[model samples]
Target: MTTGIVLIILSAALLHATWNTIVKTAGDRTSTLGLVALGHVIPGLVMVTVLPFPSVESWPYLIASTVIHFGYFYMLGQAYKHGDLSVVYPIARGIVPALVSLWAMLFVGEILPAQAWYGIALIAVAIQISSWAALRHGVGRAALFFALGTGFCISGYSLVDGVGVRLSGDTLSYWAWHSVLHIFIVGFIALRRGNAIRALPRRTWMIGILGGIVSMTAYGLVLYAKNFAPLGAVSALRETSVIFAALIGFVFLGEGNWRRRLLAAVLMAGGVALIGLSI
Candidate 1:
């Protein structure tokens, strides 16, 4: 990947961590999650109106991606409810790089360089290290299960969008449609918890929507970079968000051991450097 693409993906990583932090801090996670989905929907509605529709060929992947996101959002909310952001975020994002690499190789026929694979392995290790304390002490079976489920959903959507964006002819249009389709996720949450959602404070709504905007921007950046880079490399680099999440949890949420998190960050940075150099 080029320097520009690396920087773009890194920026996305930061934004990704930021939004997750927003969700982690929220009092009503499910309602905040719905607002986050609405965040995507609001911009998506305007963008779809103005942007060209994604190609017909990409529709299947688009729909599939939206479906996967439902599981992702659900698992993420559940995981947060059961564990700290520091614990849940790392586990949830930790497994995605390898899973996306494997899926890309098996299904998409995308082979990454050996060095990139090593970098990916290093990142995977770093992710686990970031969560070592939680792992040792136990983050609860429910948290572990939900976090793993979230990781699976993330990998699924990553591969689908990586190929889908390439075929869509226009990355922004594909993203716009994908964002608009988040309406289903938002609607589902609303239907199940309409009374609760309706009762959330205005401040909560604003923060959640803002978080959604950040999340949408992060997704757009990753999709744009996917158009230019290998899936495995992009994903390995993107999973650096776990490091960012660790820092956020420590600094903002007052969670986790900062010393261990620092070590993980250094290791992840080395992995990132390897991936950047290999590409």
Candidate 2:
């Protein structure tokens, strides 16, 4: 990958970690996510006016992606509800590269080198290490499963959007439409929460919106990077957000057991570097 692509992906990683931190810290995960979804739609609404429409063939993929993304957001909110950012975020983000690699191989026939596989293993092990202390102290099974579900949802949507955007023939159009589609799903969620929208304070709305914008921009960068890089490599590189999340958790969320979590972060960073270099 070029230096430019590396920079873009790294920048996206930071932004992705930042917004996830916001989500983990929010008082109401579902409502905050709704606000973020609204934020996502604002930019998409603007881009829709300027960009060409996605091809008809891309609509099916777009619809499928939208459903999968909704699952991702819902599961993520549930995960954060039961777990700290350091643990949940690492598990949720760490497993993505392996899952995405498997999906890409089965659906798109993209294969990574052996080194990349080793890197994936390292990342997975790092994620396991992240929870070691919690396990000794009796972590809840619910949080583990929820985080795993979140990871699965991430892999599902990553594969869907990878092919969806490629088929759309316009990255910006595909991205914009994807963001716009998030609105309906979030709306349904808000409705289900019963008057949740009215309960959000001004400050929460601002934070949620900012998080939404950052989330949109972060993945937009990844989609753009995917156009130029291998999907697995790009996904692995982005999972570096796991490490960024660890630091954010320690500093911002006041999470404990940082000694081991920091070690896991170092391993994850090494794995990310190996994956990026393999590309």
Candidate 3:
């Protein structure tokens, strides 16, 4: 990937970490997630009015992505309920790079370089290092299961969107539609907890919506970058969000041992460097 694309993806990673922090600190994860979905829907509604529709061929992937995202959100909320952000975030995102790489190779026919593979392996290792505390102390079994499920959902959508956006003819339009589709998530949450959602504090609504916007922007950037880079490489680099998440958890959420997380972050940085240089 070019320097420009690398920078874009990294920016997305930071934004992603920001939003997850927002969710982690929320009073009600399900409602907050619903509002986050609404955040996407509002902007998406406006954009779709002006943007071209994604190509017909991309619709199936888009639908699949939307379905998978529901599971992603559910898994993420459940994981956070059971574990710390530092623990849940790394395990959830860390597994994505390898899974995306494998899916891209098997289904998308994208073969990455040896260096890229090594970088991905390094990143995977660094991610495990970041979560060593959880392993030692034994994170809740529920947290581990839900986080793994979240990882699988992320991998599924990442591959789907990577290919879908490429075929859509316009990245922005594809993203706009994808954002709009999040309405289903919002609706699902509202249906399950209509009274609770209606009773949430204004501050919670504001924060959740803001987080949704951040999440939307982050995903959009990744989708755009996918148009220009290999899926595996882009995903490996994007998993840098785990480093950002670890720092956020330590500095803001007061979650873990900073020194160990920092070491993992440094190793991840090395992995990112290798992936960047490979292209």
Candidate 2 has a TM-score of 0.91
Alpha-carbon RMSD, candidate 1: 1.5
Across 94-136, the per-residue lDDT of candidate 1 in tens digits comes to 8899999999999989998888888998999999898898777
Instruction: Flag regions of model 2 displaced more than 4 Å.
Output: 77-87, 138-142
lDDT of 3 by residue, 46-147 (tens): 999998888999999999999999889889878888887667877888889999999999998999899999999888888888778876777788999998
**TM-score per candidate:** 0.95, 0.91, 0.94
lDDT of 1 at 189: 95
The model with the greater lDDT, 1 or 3, is 1
Comparing 2 and 3 on TM-score, the stronger one:
3
Candidate that would win on lDDT:
1
RMSD of each: 1.5, 2.1, 1.6
Candidate 3 global CA lDDT score: 0.89
Backbone clashes under 3 angstroms, per model: 0, 0, 0
**lDDT for each residue of candidate 2 in 42-100, tens digit (9 for 90 to 100):** 99999999999998888999999888887887788788778765567667877898899
The residue pairs in collision within model 2 are none
Q: For model 2, what is the error of residue 1's alpha carbon versus the real structure, in angstroms, after optimal superposition?
A: 2.6
Quote the lDDT for 268 in model 1.
91
The deviation in Å at residue 175 for candidate 2 is 0.8
